[model samples]
Target: MKQAPFIAVEGPIGAGKTTLASMLAEELNLPIIKEIVDENPFLAKFYENMDDWSFQLEMFFLCNRYKQLEDTVTQYIDKGNPVISDYHIYKNLIFGERTLNGTKREKYRQIYHVLTDDLPKPNIILYIKANLDTLLTRIEKRGRPFEEGMDTAYLEQLIKDYDDAMASLAIQEPSTVIITIDGNAVDFVENPEHFTEIVSYIKELMK
Candidate 1:
């Protein structure tokens, strides 16, 4: 049996991870498993008061993502076609660590480890990055009601964390191919060439 190809597109909010992942999936004829952010009831409150709701929100996401992947990953395994995802499993810990205290973070990691022990890691991780200003603009333009109060300070902190994670990806997980793209520079929606280049990269890595 052949292994199914898996690709994860990750970044801070509004970095175009979802848009790019959808485009890549369509272009490459792959199915996609998107993050379940909309189902998270605490998200709006968490954004409004990170100090109060961060841990709960993060745990919810961690458990939800794990459950979804467990149910879906086997279907794709060895099937030869790729599965494109907007967010990866690591985001649970990546974003969780930002708000969790030492003890709470440790506990979250322990649970996360056990839950994701057998899950398939991505064959390729596409990291999309844009300037903070660019992300803010995109987020505002999309106008999700929950995002109305999102502030620059929060976004800047998240961007810093994302960069740190990608910087360590090579040494941390040498088996996976990690690719960084400048989303601010790409016309993902209008330029077919840009989209094609991304799809080509994923295809090459899968091969």
Candidate 2:
């Protein structure tokens, strides 16, 4: 039986997930779903005091991601076509561990595991990797107010967590479809070759 087509572009902050998602959607003639960052009412405060607002911020993201997944899952069941998203369901948990404290982290793990139980996994994941300097530069270039005081320490920790998660994911689902791409080489927002490469890759995946 042919499975529903789903594609995800996942990476740490400033990795261009949103721009890539949008471009992929355009090329594939699919709708785009991005992270609910703007919807988070606590994001500004969370940026100011990560320790205090980490749990709260993560909870908001968890809820938002679940809802986003629900919508996509429904579409897959009904329409049986392609969809592209900026982030995957489990990426929320990745951020959760980096942001939440010990006790809250445990709770986050439990909820994340439960919420993702029946969520549809992507047919292919495009993982973008970039160094800290590149990431920081991209973050600043974007000029989001909430990202103004972003700490390098927090970004570094997220990088480690993302690496650990991808490594474990490879182990747990050895056969899962994945493609690791170097973000440093790709400028989806500015250049054409990088965007062409990404679109080409996704086309191959679809075939």
- How far residue 7's Cα lies from its native spot in candidate 1, in Å, is 0.4
RMSD of 2: 1.5
Q: lDDT by residue for model 1 over 69-89, one digit each (tens)?
A: 875676675455568889888
Report the C-alpha lDDT of model 2 over 73-182, residue by residue, as the tens digit: 78763478778889878788788877777888999999998988876777678888888888999899999999987889889888788778888777765655777878
Indicate the residue-level lDDT of 15 in model 1: 90
Candidate 2 regions exceeding 4 Å error are none
- The candidate 2 region of ten consecutive residues with least summed lDDT is 168-177
Weakest lDDT window of 10 consecutive positions for candidate 1: 71-80
Q: How close to the true structure is residue 124 of candidate 2, measured as C-alpha lDDT?
A: 77
For each candidate in turn, the TM-score is 0.93, 0.93
The lDDT values for all models are 0.83, 0.83
After aligning candidate 1 to the native by TM-score, how far in Å is the CA of 139 from where it should be?
0.4
